[model samples]
Target: AQSVTQPDIHITVSEGASLELRCNYSYGATPYLFWYVQSPGQGLQLLLKYFSGDTLVQGIKGFEAEFKRSQSSFNLRKPSVHWSDAAEYFCAFFTGGGNKLTFGTGTQLKVEL
Candidate 1:
Protein backbone atom coordinates (compact mmCIF):
# COMPACT_ATOMS: atom_id res chain seq x y z
CA ALA A 1 0.00 0.00 0.00
CA GLN A 2 1.21 3.48 -0.85
CA SER A 3 0.60 6.37 1.51
CA VAL A 4 1.72 9.86 2.38
CA THR A 5 2.08 11.14 5.92
CA GLN A 6 2.62 14.59 7.36
CA PRO A 7 3.89 14.46 10.91
CA ASP A 8 2.83 17.93 11.91
CA ILE A 9 -0.85 18.62 12.33
CA HIS A 10 -0.19 22.29 12.85
CA ILE A 11 2.75 24.67 12.81
CA THR A 12 3.13 28.27 13.97
CA VAL A 13 5.92 30.42 12.65
CA SER A 14 6.58 34.11 12.91
CA GLU A 15 6.20 36.14 9.76
CA GLY A 16 9.48 36.46 7.88
CA ALA A 17 10.98 33.37 9.50
CA SER A 18 12.05 30.17 7.86
CA LEU A 19 9.70 27.20 7.69
CA GLU A 20 10.00 23.48 7.11
CA LEU A 21 7.23 20.96 6.68
CA ARG A 22 7.91 17.30 7.13
CA CYS A 23 6.58 14.67 4.75
CA ASN A 24 7.16 10.95 4.41
CA TYR A 25 5.79 8.38 2.02
CA SER A 26 5.59 4.65 1.68
CA TYR A 27 5.51 3.36 -1.86
CA GLY A 28 6.76 0.38 -3.77
CA ALA A 29 8.09 2.34 -6.74
CA THR A 30 8.95 5.90 -7.62
CA PRO A 31 5.75 7.92 -7.46
CA TYR A 32 4.71 11.34 -8.66
CA LEU A 33 5.21 13.62 -5.69
CA PHE A 34 3.59 17.02 -5.19
CA TRP A 35 3.14 19.74 -2.64
CA TYR A 36 0.03 21.88 -2.63
CA VAL A 37 -1.03 24.87 -0.59
CA GLN A 38 -4.62 25.80 0.00
CA SER A 39 -5.89 28.98 1.49
CA PRO A 40 -8.98 28.96 3.65
CA GLY A 41 -12.13 28.17 1.70
CA GLN A 42 -10.21 27.83 -1.54
CA GLY A 43 -8.86 25.16 -3.82
CA LEU A 44 -5.34 23.84 -3.50
CA GLN A 45 -2.54 25.38 -5.54
CA LEU A 46 0.41 23.37 -6.73
CA LEU A 47 3.63 24.41 -5.08
CA LEU A 48 5.89 21.91 -6.74
CA LYS A 49 6.23 18.40 -8.05
CA TYR A 50 8.89 15.73 -8.65
CA PHE A 51 8.22 13.46 -11.61
CA SER A 52 11.55 11.75 -12.47
CA GLY A 53 14.22 14.35 -12.91
CA ASP A 54 16.43 16.15 -10.42
CA THR A 55 16.12 15.56 -6.73
CA LEU A 56 15.64 19.24 -6.06
CA VAL A 57 12.59 21.02 -7.48
CA GLN A 58 11.41 24.59 -7.05
CA GLY A 59 7.97 26.06 -7.29
CA ILE A 60 5.87 29.18 -6.93
CA LYS A 61 5.88 31.51 -3.95
CA GLY A 62 9.54 30.97 -3.23
CA PHE A 63 9.14 27.36 -2.14
CA GLU A 64 11.43 24.45 -2.86
CA ALA A 65 11.73 20.79 -1.90
CA GLU A 66 14.27 18.02 -2.19
CA PHE A 67 13.27 14.47 -2.87
CA LYS A 68 15.29 11.81 -1.09
CA ARG A 69 14.42 8.38 -2.35
CA SER A 70 16.49 6.52 0.23
CA GLN A 71 14.98 8.48 3.08
CA SER A 72 11.48 8.22 1.63
CA SER A 73 11.06 11.88 2.29
CA PHE A 74 10.08 15.01 0.32
CA ASN A 75 10.14 17.94 2.67
CA LEU A 76 9.12 21.53 1.83
CA ARG A 77 11.24 24.47 2.90
CA LYS A 78 11.04 28.25 2.66
CA PRO A 79 13.80 30.64 3.58
CA SER A 80 11.43 33.41 4.62
CA VAL A 81 7.72 33.00 4.98
CA HIS A 82 5.09 35.66 4.80
CA TRP A 83 1.83 36.08 6.64
CA SER A 84 0.01 35.42 3.40
CA ASP A 85 1.77 32.10 3.23
CA ALA A 86 -0.24 30.85 6.16
CA ALA A 87 -2.47 28.08 4.91
CA GLU A 88 -3.09 24.37 4.80
CA TYR A 89 -0.42 22.36 3.00
CA PHE A 90 -0.99 18.87 1.72
CA CYS A 91 1.60 16.40 0.49
CA ALA A 92 0.18 14.26 -2.28
CA PHE A 93 1.27 11.36 -4.48
CA PHE A 94 0.02 9.77 -7.65
CA THR A 95 0.20 6.05 -8.31
CA GLY A 96 1.03 6.74 -12.00
CA GLY A 97 -1.83 4.73 -13.49
CA GLY A 98 -5.34 6.13 -13.33
CA ASN A 99 -4.57 9.72 -12.38
CA LYS A 100 -5.61 8.98 -8.84
CA LEU A 101 -4.23 11.09 -6.03
CA THR A 102 -3.65 10.34 -2.34
CA PHE A 103 -3.32 13.24 0.04
CA GLY A 104 -1.93 13.58 3.51
CA THR A 105 -4.12 14.77 6.35
CA GLY A 106 -2.61 18.22 5.90
CA THR A 107 -0.60 20.67 8.03
CA GLN A 108 -2.06 24.03 9.00
CA LEU A 109 0.41 26.86 9.17
CA LYS A 110 -0.14 29.86 11.41
CA VAL A 111 1.82 32.99 10.75
CA GLU A 112 2.48 35.15 13.78
CA LEU A 113 3.61 38.72 13.52
Candidate 2:
Protein backbone atom coordinates (compact mmCIF):
# COMPACT_ATOMS: atom_id res chain seq x y z
CA ALA A 1 0.00 0.00 0.00
CA GLN A 2 1.19 3.47 -0.85
CA SER A 3 1.02 6.43 1.47
CA VAL A 4 1.74 10.13 1.36
CA THR A 5 3.23 12.12 4.18
CA GLN A 6 3.33 15.87 4.53
CA PRO A 7 5.82 16.56 7.30
CA ASP A 8 4.68 20.09 7.87
CA ILE A 9 1.18 20.45 9.22
CA HIS A 10 1.37 24.21 8.89
CA ILE A 11 3.62 26.58 7.06
CA THR A 12 3.88 30.34 7.25
CA VAL A 13 5.55 32.47 4.63
CA SER A 14 5.70 36.13 3.89
CA GLU A 15 3.84 37.36 0.87
CA GLY A 16 6.05 37.66 -2.20
CA ALA A 17 8.50 35.15 -0.74
CA SER A 18 9.46 31.95 -2.45
CA LEU A 19 7.60 28.91 -1.24
CA GLU A 20 8.34 25.22 -1.16
CA LEU A 21 6.11 22.55 0.32
CA ARG A 22 7.51 19.15 1.14
CA CYS A 23 5.86 15.88 0.18
CA ASN A 24 7.22 12.37 0.57
CA TYR A 25 5.68 9.12 -0.60
CA SER A 26 6.16 5.45 0.09
CA TYR A 27 5.41 3.18 -2.84
CA GLY A 28 6.92 0.11 -4.45
CA ALA A 29 6.87 1.36 -8.00
CA THR A 30 6.75 4.80 -9.51
CA PRO A 31 3.35 5.97 -8.48
CA TYR A 32 1.61 9.14 -9.54
CA LEU A 33 2.30 12.28 -7.52
CA PHE A 34 -0.17 15.10 -7.20
CA TRP A 35 -0.43 18.41 -5.38
CA TYR A 36 -3.84 19.86 -4.73
CA VAL A 37 -4.76 23.13 -3.12
CA GLN A 38 -8.06 23.97 -1.44
CA SER A 39 -9.26 27.29 -0.22
CA PRO A 40 -11.48 27.57 2.81
CA GLY A 41 -14.90 26.15 2.05
CA GLN A 42 -13.79 25.32 -1.49
CA GLY A 43 -13.09 22.13 -3.35
CA LEU A 44 -9.63 20.84 -4.11
CA GLN A 45 -7.88 22.25 -7.13
CA LEU A 46 -5.16 20.36 -8.99
CA LEU A 47 -1.90 22.18 -8.68
CA LEU A 48 0.48 19.79 -10.44
CA LYS A 49 1.12 16.15 -11.21
CA TYR A 50 4.01 13.79 -11.94
CA PHE A 51 3.26 10.63 -13.86
CA SER A 52 6.27 9.82 -16.00
CA GLY A 53 8.96 11.03 -18.34
CA ASP A 54 10.54 14.32 -17.34
CA THR A 55 11.20 14.51 -13.64
CA LEU A 56 10.26 18.17 -13.51
CA VAL A 57 6.61 19.03 -14.18
CA GLN A 58 4.90 22.38 -14.34
CA GLY A 59 1.46 23.15 -13.02
CA ILE A 60 -1.11 25.95 -12.87
CA LYS A 61 -1.09 28.93 -10.52
CA GLY A 62 2.62 29.43 -10.89
CA PHE A 63 3.42 26.11 -9.30
CA GLU A 64 5.94 23.45 -10.24
CA ALA A 65 7.13 20.13 -8.83
CA GLU A 66 10.07 17.87 -9.34
CA PHE A 67 9.70 14.14 -9.06
CA LYS A 68 12.70 12.66 -7.32
CA ARG A 69 12.51 8.92 -7.48
CA SER A 70 15.62 8.45 -5.40
CA GLN A 71 14.32 10.68 -2.66
CA SER A 72 10.76 9.41 -3.05
CA SER A 73 9.64 12.99 -3.04
CA PHE A 74 7.59 15.35 -5.17
CA ASN A 75 8.03 18.74 -3.65
CA LEU A 76 6.00 21.72 -4.83
CA ARG A 77 7.61 25.09 -5.36
CA LYS A 78 6.58 28.59 -6.30
CA PRO A 79 8.82 31.49 -7.17
CA SER A 80 6.73 33.92 -5.18
CA VAL A 81 3.63 33.40 -3.12
CA HIS A 82 0.73 35.80 -2.84
CA TRP A 83 -1.73 36.43 -0.04
CA SER A 84 -4.37 34.72 -2.13
CA ASP A 85 -2.21 31.60 -2.18
CA ALA A 86 -2.97 30.92 1.44
CA ALA A 87 -4.80 27.61 1.54
CA GLU A 88 -4.66 24.00 2.57
CA TYR A 89 -2.37 21.94 0.39
CA PHE A 90 -2.60 18.22 0.06
CA CYS A 91 -0.25 15.60 -1.29
CA ALA A 92 -1.75 12.55 -2.92
CA PHE A 93 -0.62 9.34 -4.56
CA PHE A 94 -2.39 7.07 -7.03
CA THR A 95 -1.16 3.57 -7.82
CA GLY A 96 -2.85 3.64 -11.26
CA GLY A 97 -4.45 0.27 -10.49
CA GLY A 98 -7.37 1.77 -8.62
CA ASN A 99 -9.42 4.92 -8.56
CA LYS A 100 -8.59 5.52 -4.94
CA LEU A 101 -6.07 8.15 -4.01
CA THR A 102 -4.12 8.12 -0.74
CA PHE A 103 -3.69 11.62 0.57
CA GLY A 104 -1.65 13.32 3.24
CA THR A 105 -3.09 15.00 6.28
CA GLY A 106 -2.56 18.36 4.57
CA THR A 107 -0.43 21.43 5.11
CA GLN A 108 -2.12 24.70 5.88
CA LEU A 109 -0.32 27.61 4.27
CA LYS A 110 -0.39 31.06 5.80
CA VAL A 111 0.93 34.02 3.89
CA GLU A 112 1.84 36.91 6.14
CA LEU A 113 1.69 40.30 4.55
Candidate 3:
Protein backbone atom coordinates (compact mmCIF):
# COMPACT_ATOMS: atom_id res chain seq x y z
CA ALA A 1 0.00 0.00 0.00
CA GLN A 2 1.04 3.57 -0.61
CA SER A 3 0.63 6.44 1.78
CA VAL A 4 1.53 10.12 2.07
CA THR A 5 2.77 12.15 4.95
CA GLN A 6 2.82 15.92 5.32
CA PRO A 7 5.07 16.88 8.21
CA ASP A 8 3.66 20.35 8.64
CA ILE A 9 0.06 20.44 9.73
CA HIS A 10 -0.07 24.18 9.25
CA ILE A 11 2.14 26.76 7.59
CA THR A 12 2.21 30.53 7.41
CA VAL A 13 3.80 32.69 4.75
CA SER A 14 3.74 36.34 3.89
CA GLU A 15 2.17 37.51 0.71
CA GLY A 16 4.61 37.59 -2.23
CA ALA A 17 7.02 35.37 -0.37
CA SER A 18 8.22 31.98 -1.43
CA LEU A 19 6.57 28.86 -0.01
CA GLU A 20 7.38 25.21 0.19
CA LEU A 21 5.25 22.35 1.45
CA ARG A 22 6.83 19.05 2.27
CA CYS A 23 5.42 15.68 1.31
CA ASN A 24 6.81 12.21 1.72
CA TYR A 25 5.46 8.95 0.40
CA SER A 26 5.94 5.26 1.09
CA TYR A 27 5.65 2.74 -1.69
CA GLY A 28 7.43 -0.28 -3.08
CA ALA A 29 7.95 1.11 -6.55
CA THR A 30 7.61 4.49 -8.17
CA PRO A 31 4.07 5.64 -7.53
CA TYR A 32 1.86 8.31 -8.93
CA LEU A 33 2.03 11.50 -6.93
CA PHE A 34 -0.25 14.48 -6.94
CA TRP A 35 -0.77 17.81 -5.22
CA TYR A 36 -4.22 19.20 -4.64
CA VAL A 37 -5.48 22.40 -3.12
CA GLN A 38 -8.86 23.01 -1.58
CA SER A 39 -10.11 26.43 -0.69
CA PRO A 40 -12.70 26.93 1.99
CA GLY A 41 -15.98 25.39 0.90
CA GLN A 42 -14.51 24.39 -2.41
CA GLY A 43 -13.69 21.05 -3.98
CA LEU A 44 -10.20 19.68 -4.41
CA GLN A 45 -8.29 21.23 -7.29
CA LEU A 46 -5.39 19.50 -8.97
CA LEU A 47 -2.25 21.50 -8.51
CA LEU A 48 0.29 19.15 -10.09
CA LYS A 49 1.07 15.55 -10.80
CA TYR A 50 4.03 13.27 -11.43
CA PHE A 51 3.85 9.88 -13.02
CA SER A 52 6.94 9.83 -15.15
CA GLY A 53 9.22 11.87 -17.38
CA ASP A 54 10.70 15.00 -15.86
CA THR A 55 11.56 15.10 -12.21
CA LEU A 56 10.36 18.68 -12.04
CA VAL A 57 6.70 19.23 -12.79
CA GLN A 58 4.82 22.51 -13.07
CA GLY A 59 1.21 23.07 -12.31
CA ILE A 60 -1.36 25.83 -12.17
CA LYS A 61 -1.07 28.95 -10.00
CA GLY A 62 2.67 29.18 -10.37
CA PHE A 63 3.20 26.02 -8.39
CA GLU A 64 5.81 23.36 -9.09
CA ALA A 65 7.03 20.15 -7.51
CA GLU A 66 10.08 17.99 -7.80
CA PHE A 67 10.01 14.23 -7.51
CA LYS A 68 13.04 12.98 -5.68
CA ARG A 69 13.15 9.21 -5.69
CA SER A 70 16.04 9.09 -3.27
CA GLN A 71 14.33 11.18 -0.68
CA SER A 72 10.90 9.72 -1.38
CA SER A 73 9.63 13.29 -1.42
CA PHE A 74 7.61 15.46 -3.74
CA ASN A 75 7.57 18.89 -2.22
CA LEU A 76 5.46 21.70 -3.56
CA ARG A 77 7.02 25.08 -4.16
CA LYS A 78 5.92 28.52 -5.24
CA PRO A 79 8.22 31.39 -6.07
CA SER A 80 5.76 33.96 -4.75
CA VAL A 81 2.57 33.23 -2.97
CA HIS A 82 -0.63 35.19 -3.38
CA TRP A 83 -3.17 35.92 -0.69
CA SER A 84 -5.67 33.77 -2.50
CA ASP A 85 -3.24 30.87 -2.29
CA ALA A 86 -4.14 30.34 1.32
CA ALA A 87 -5.85 27.01 1.48
CA GLU A 88 -5.55 23.39 2.56
CA TYR A 89 -3.01 21.49 0.50
CA PHE A 90 -3.02 17.76 0.14
CA CYS A 91 -0.51 15.21 -1.10
CA ALA A 92 -1.97 12.12 -2.65
CA PHE A 93 -0.92 8.85 -4.24
CA PHE A 94 -2.90 7.07 -6.88
CA THR A 95 -3.31 3.37 -6.30
CA GLY A 96 -3.92 2.81 -10.03
CA GLY A 97 -5.93 -0.33 -9.34
CA GLY A 98 -9.38 1.00 -8.55
CA ASN A 99 -8.88 4.66 -9.18
CA LYS A 100 -8.44 5.30 -5.50
CA LEU A 101 -6.24 7.92 -3.91
CA THR A 102 -4.49 7.88 -0.58
CA PHE A 103 -4.17 11.42 0.73
CA GLY A 104 -2.11 13.02 3.40
CA THR A 105 -3.57 14.67 6.45
CA GLY A 106 -3.21 18.02 4.67
CA THR A 107 -1.38 21.23 5.42
CA GLN A 108 -3.26 24.43 5.99
CA LEU A 109 -1.54 27.49 4.57
CA LYS A 110 -2.12 30.88 6.13
CA VAL A 111 -1.11 33.92 4.18
CA GLU A 112 -0.16 37.00 6.11
CA LEU A 113 0.08 40.50 4.77
For model 3, the superposed segments whose C-alpha errors exceed 4 Å read 96-98
Tens-place lDDT digits, model 2, residues 1-108:
578999999999999999999999999988988999999999999998888999999999899999998999999999999999999999999966858889999999
Model 1, global lDDT: 0.95
lDDT of 3 by residue, 9-71 (tens): 999999999999999999888889999999999999999999999999999999999999999
Query: In model 2, what lDDT does residue 100 have?
Result: 81
RMSD values, in order shown: 0.9, 1.0, 1.1
Candidates' lDDT values, in order?
Answer: 0.95, 0.94, 0.96
Candidate 1 per-residue lDDT, tens place, 1-93, comes to 789999999999999999999999998989889999999999999999999889999999999999999999999999999999999999999
- What's the distance in Å from true for residue 74, model 2? 0.3
- Return the TM-score for candidate 2, rounded to 2 decimals: 0.96
As for candidate 2, its clashing pairs are none
Query: For model 2, where is the 10-residue window of minimal lDDT?
Result: 93-102
